[model samples]
Target: MPISHIEHYNLRAERSMLETLRDFYVTVVGLQVGYRPLSSYGYWLYAGERALLHLSEARPGDPREPHLRSTFDHVAFACTDLPACEAHLRNHGIDYRYAEVPATGQRQLFFSDPAGNGIELNFAATPDS
Candidate 1:
Protein backbone atom coordinates (compact mmCIF):
# COMPACT_ATOMS: atom_id res chain seq x y z
CA MET A 1 0.00 0.00 0.00
CA PRO A 2 1.01 3.60 -0.62
CA ILE A 3 1.90 5.96 2.14
CA SER A 4 -1.10 7.80 3.58
CA HIS A 5 -0.22 11.27 4.90
CA ILE A 6 1.71 13.18 7.50
CA GLU A 7 0.89 11.97 10.98
CA HIS A 8 2.44 14.64 13.10
CA TYR A 9 4.93 17.51 13.34
CA ASN A 10 7.43 18.14 16.11
CA LEU A 11 8.31 21.79 16.63
CA ARG A 12 10.93 23.25 18.94
CA ALA A 13 10.74 26.55 20.73
CA GLU A 14 12.60 27.99 23.70
CA ARG A 15 11.97 25.94 26.86
CA SER A 16 10.00 28.75 28.45
CA MET A 17 7.80 29.24 25.41
CA LEU A 18 5.63 26.15 25.73
CA GLU A 19 2.57 27.72 27.31
CA THR A 20 2.20 30.41 24.70
CA LEU A 21 2.70 27.90 21.94
CA ARG A 22 0.14 25.58 23.48
CA ASP A 23 -2.38 28.39 23.76
CA PHE A 24 -1.92 29.30 20.12
CA TYR A 25 -2.44 25.72 19.01
CA VAL A 26 -5.45 25.23 21.25
CA THR A 27 -7.37 28.50 21.37
CA VAL A 28 -6.37 30.08 18.10
CA VAL A 29 -5.76 27.13 15.84
CA GLY A 30 -8.32 24.73 17.32
CA LEU A 31 -6.24 21.64 18.01
CA GLN A 32 -6.78 19.41 21.04
CA VAL A 33 -3.99 17.93 23.08
CA GLY A 34 -3.70 14.20 22.86
CA TYR A 35 -2.03 11.45 24.94
CA ARG A 36 1.40 12.06 26.37
CA PRO A 37 4.29 9.63 26.59
CA LEU A 38 5.79 9.32 30.09
CA SER A 39 9.27 10.50 29.23
CA SER A 40 8.23 13.81 27.68
CA TYR A 41 6.46 16.99 28.69
CA GLY A 42 5.33 17.77 25.16
CA TYR A 43 1.77 16.97 24.16
CA TRP A 44 0.46 15.60 20.89
CA LEU A 45 -2.12 17.93 19.40
CA TYR A 46 -4.79 16.34 17.29
CA ALA A 47 -6.52 17.67 14.21
CA GLY A 48 -7.19 14.10 13.16
CA GLU A 49 -5.54 10.74 13.63
CA ARG A 50 -3.05 11.49 10.87
CA ALA A 51 -2.70 15.20 11.54
CA LEU A 52 -1.03 16.20 14.77
CA LEU A 53 1.34 18.86 16.07
CA HIS A 54 3.90 17.91 18.67
CA LEU A 55 5.61 20.66 20.64
CA SER A 56 9.01 19.91 22.06
CA GLU A 57 11.22 21.92 24.39
CA ALA A 58 14.33 23.41 22.89
CA ARG A 59 17.82 22.77 24.12
CA PRO A 60 20.07 25.72 24.88
CA GLY A 61 22.43 26.53 22.03
CA ASP A 62 23.32 29.20 19.53
CA PRO A 63 20.22 30.47 17.78
CA ARG A 64 22.26 30.93 14.62
CA GLU A 65 23.01 27.23 14.32
CA PRO A 66 22.43 25.91 10.83
CA HIS A 67 20.47 22.81 11.90
CA LEU A 68 17.86 25.07 13.44
CA ARG A 69 17.44 27.08 10.26
CA SER A 70 15.50 24.37 8.48
CA THR A 71 12.96 24.21 11.31
CA PHE A 72 12.58 27.97 11.46
CA ASP A 73 11.41 28.64 7.94
CA HIS A 74 7.72 27.66 7.89
CA VAL A 75 5.07 24.96 7.70
CA ALA A 76 2.02 25.22 5.50
CA PHE A 77 -1.50 23.94 6.12
CA ALA A 78 -4.30 23.92 3.58
CA CYS A 79 -7.47 25.81 4.39
CA THR A 80 -10.96 24.66 3.60
CA ASP A 81 -11.75 27.98 1.94
CA LEU A 82 -9.83 31.20 1.58
CA PRO A 83 -12.30 33.68 3.03
CA ALA A 84 -13.06 31.71 6.14
CA CYS A 85 -9.40 31.09 6.76
CA GLU A 86 -8.53 34.77 6.34
CA ALA A 87 -11.26 35.81 8.74
CA HIS A 88 -10.14 33.25 11.30
CA LEU A 89 -6.60 34.57 11.22
CA ARG A 90 -7.83 38.12 11.59
CA ASN A 91 -10.09 37.21 14.46
CA HIS A 92 -7.14 35.67 16.23
CA GLY A 93 -5.18 38.91 15.69
CA ILE A 94 -2.56 37.23 13.54
CA ASP A 95 -0.87 39.26 10.80
CA TYR A 96 -0.17 37.52 7.51
CA ARG A 97 1.38 38.19 4.12
CA TYR A 98 -0.60 37.07 1.10
CA ALA A 99 0.68 35.76 -2.22
CA GLU A 100 -0.62 34.01 -5.29
CA VAL A 101 1.41 31.45 -7.22
CA PRO A 102 0.43 31.84 -10.87
CA ALA A 103 1.81 28.56 -12.14
CA THR A 104 -0.14 26.37 -9.72
CA GLY A 105 -2.97 28.84 -9.20
CA GLN A 106 -2.64 28.53 -5.45
CA ARG A 107 -3.08 31.37 -2.98
CA GLN A 108 -1.17 31.47 0.29
CA LEU A 109 -0.85 33.66 3.35
CA PHE A 110 2.05 33.43 5.74
CA PHE A 111 2.01 34.18 9.44
CA SER A 112 3.91 33.39 12.59
CA ASP A 113 3.06 31.78 15.91
CA PRO A 114 3.80 33.12 19.38
CA ALA A 115 7.31 31.70 19.36
CA GLY A 116 7.93 33.10 15.85
CA ASN A 117 7.52 29.83 13.98
CA GLY A 118 6.21 30.49 10.48
CA ILE A 119 2.89 29.09 9.27
CA GLU A 120 1.18 29.18 5.89
CA LEU A 121 -2.52 29.11 5.13
CA ASN A 122 -3.22 27.91 1.60
CA PHE A 123 -6.21 27.41 -0.67
CA ALA A 124 -6.61 25.85 -4.07
CA ALA A 125 -7.65 27.71 -7.24
CA THR A 126 -11.00 26.16 -7.91
CA PRO A 127 -13.58 23.63 -6.81
CA ASP A 128 -13.21 21.28 -9.76
CA SER A 129 -10.28 22.40 -11.85
Candidate 2:
Protein backbone atom coordinates (compact mmCIF):
# COMPACT_ATOMS: atom_id res chain seq x y z
CA MET A 1 0.00 0.00 0.00
CA PRO A 2 1.13 3.51 -0.75
CA ILE A 3 1.39 6.15 1.90
CA SER A 4 -0.59 9.36 1.58
CA HIS A 5 0.37 12.94 2.30
CA ILE A 6 1.38 14.11 5.76
CA GLU A 7 -1.49 13.55 8.09
CA HIS A 8 -0.22 16.05 10.62
CA TYR A 9 2.85 17.43 12.37
CA ASN A 10 3.39 17.63 16.11
CA LEU A 11 5.46 19.99 18.25
CA ARG A 12 6.23 19.13 21.84
CA ALA A 13 7.35 21.57 24.50
CA GLU A 14 6.97 22.18 28.17
CA ARG A 15 3.50 22.96 29.45
CA SER A 16 3.89 26.75 29.38
CA MET A 17 5.65 26.82 26.04
CA LEU A 18 3.13 24.39 24.70
CA GLU A 19 0.42 26.91 25.50
CA THR A 20 2.38 29.64 23.80
CA LEU A 21 2.87 27.42 20.79
CA ARG A 22 -0.85 26.88 20.66
CA ASP A 23 -1.46 30.62 20.76
CA PHE A 24 1.13 31.33 18.09
CA TYR A 25 -0.14 28.67 15.71
CA VAL A 26 -3.72 29.75 16.28
CA THR A 27 -3.38 33.54 16.25
CA VAL A 28 -0.40 34.05 13.98
CA VAL A 29 -0.67 31.02 11.73
CA GLY A 30 -4.45 31.24 11.19
CA LEU A 31 -5.24 27.82 12.59
CA GLN A 32 -8.28 27.12 14.71
CA VAL A 33 -8.27 25.18 17.99
CA GLY A 34 -10.56 22.27 17.41
CA TYR A 35 -11.71 19.07 19.07
CA ARG A 36 -8.85 16.95 20.35
CA PRO A 37 -9.92 13.48 21.50
CA LEU A 38 -6.83 12.89 23.56
CA SER A 39 -7.29 14.08 27.12
CA SER A 40 -3.83 15.51 27.44
CA TYR A 41 -2.27 18.91 27.77
CA GLY A 42 -2.12 19.97 24.14
CA TYR A 43 -4.09 21.31 21.22
CA TRP A 44 -5.16 20.24 17.77
CA LEU A 45 -5.07 23.05 15.27
CA TYR A 46 -7.20 22.79 12.18
CA ALA A 47 -7.01 24.61 8.88
CA GLY A 48 -10.58 23.57 8.02
CA GLU A 49 -11.87 20.13 8.92
CA ARG A 50 -8.46 18.45 9.02
CA ALA A 51 -6.10 18.97 11.93
CA LEU A 52 -2.75 19.68 10.35
CA LEU A 53 -0.77 20.74 13.43
CA HIS A 54 -0.58 19.17 16.86
CA LEU A 55 0.86 20.81 19.96
CA SER A 56 1.80 18.56 22.84
CA GLU A 57 3.24 19.01 26.32
CA ALA A 58 6.63 17.50 26.88
CA ARG A 59 6.84 15.32 29.94
CA PRO A 60 9.65 15.56 32.45
CA GLY A 61 12.66 13.30 31.77
CA ASP A 62 11.75 13.10 28.12
CA PRO A 63 14.97 13.00 26.17
CA ARG A 64 15.33 16.05 23.93
CA GLU A 65 18.37 16.08 21.71
CA PRO A 66 19.59 19.30 20.16
CA HIS A 67 20.09 17.59 16.84
CA LEU A 68 16.51 16.34 16.87
CA ARG A 69 15.22 19.90 16.84
CA SER A 70 17.76 21.25 14.38
CA THR A 71 17.93 18.35 11.96
CA PHE A 72 14.85 19.28 9.97
CA ASP A 73 15.39 22.63 8.33
CA HIS A 74 11.86 23.88 8.73
CA VAL A 75 8.19 23.11 8.33
CA ALA A 76 6.40 24.97 5.53
CA PHE A 77 2.76 25.86 5.23
CA ALA A 78 1.02 26.96 2.05
CA CYS A 79 -0.42 30.41 2.61
CA THR A 80 -2.20 33.31 0.92
CA ASP A 81 -2.34 37.11 1.23
CA LEU A 82 1.34 37.89 1.45
CA PRO A 83 0.78 41.47 2.51
CA ALA A 84 -1.57 40.52 5.30
CA CYS A 85 0.77 37.79 6.52
CA GLU A 86 3.67 40.21 6.52
CA ALA A 87 1.65 42.72 8.47
CA HIS A 88 0.60 40.13 10.98
CA LEU A 89 4.17 39.05 11.58
CA ARG A 90 5.28 42.66 11.92
CA ASN A 91 2.44 43.43 14.31
CA HIS A 92 3.56 40.53 16.44
CA GLY A 93 7.09 41.94 16.38
CA ILE A 94 8.39 38.79 14.73
CA ASP A 95 11.36 39.28 12.43
CA TYR A 96 11.03 37.50 9.10
CA ARG A 97 12.80 37.39 5.75
CA TYR A 98 11.14 37.47 2.34
CA ALA A 99 12.20 35.57 -0.76
CA GLU A 100 10.88 34.37 -4.09
CA VAL A 101 11.52 31.31 -6.15
CA PRO A 102 13.41 32.41 -9.28
CA ALA A 103 11.74 29.84 -11.48
CA THR A 104 8.19 29.91 -10.13
CA GLY A 105 8.12 33.41 -8.68
CA GLN A 106 6.35 32.02 -5.64
CA ARG A 107 6.72 34.24 -2.57
CA GLN A 108 7.95 32.98 0.80
CA LEU A 109 8.22 34.41 4.30
CA PHE A 110 10.57 32.80 6.79
CA PHE A 111 10.66 33.25 10.56
CA SER A 112 11.19 31.39 13.79
CA ASP A 113 8.72 30.52 16.48
CA PRO A 114 9.13 31.35 20.17
CA ALA A 115 10.94 28.05 20.64
CA GLY A 116 13.20 28.82 17.66
CA ASN A 117 11.53 26.44 15.25
CA GLY A 118 11.74 27.73 11.69
CA ILE A 119 8.44 28.47 9.98
CA GLU A 120 7.89 29.16 6.32
CA LEU A 121 4.88 30.54 4.52
CA ASN A 122 4.55 30.12 0.76
CA PHE A 123 2.33 32.22 -1.45
CA ALA A 124 1.48 32.02 -5.12
CA ALA A 125 2.93 34.68 -7.33
CA THR A 126 0.75 37.70 -7.98
CA PRO A 127 -0.33 38.27 -11.54
CA ASP A 128 0.82 41.35 -13.42
CA SER A 129 -1.70 43.87 -14.67
Q: What's model 1's lDDT at 33?
A: 81
- Provide the global lDDT of candidate 2 against the true structure: 0.85
Q: What is the TM-score of each candidate against the true structure?
A: 0.75, 0.90
Candidate 2 on 26-46: residue-level lDDT in tens? 888889999999988889999
Q: Please write out the lDDT profile of model 1 over residues 1-129, one tens digit for every residue.
A: 798887677876665577678888888676888776747566677776644788776666824221334535887787667888788889988888999998988999998877667878788888553
lDDT of 1 at 107: 93
Compared with the true structure, all predictions reach lDDT values of: 0.74, 0.85
Q: What is the lDDT of candidate 1?
A: 0.74
Task: Name model 1 segments beyond 4 Å from true.
Answer: 1-7, 59-71
- Give the Å error, residue 78, model 2: 0.9
Q: Write out the backbone clash pairs for model 2.
A: none
Best by lDDT: 2
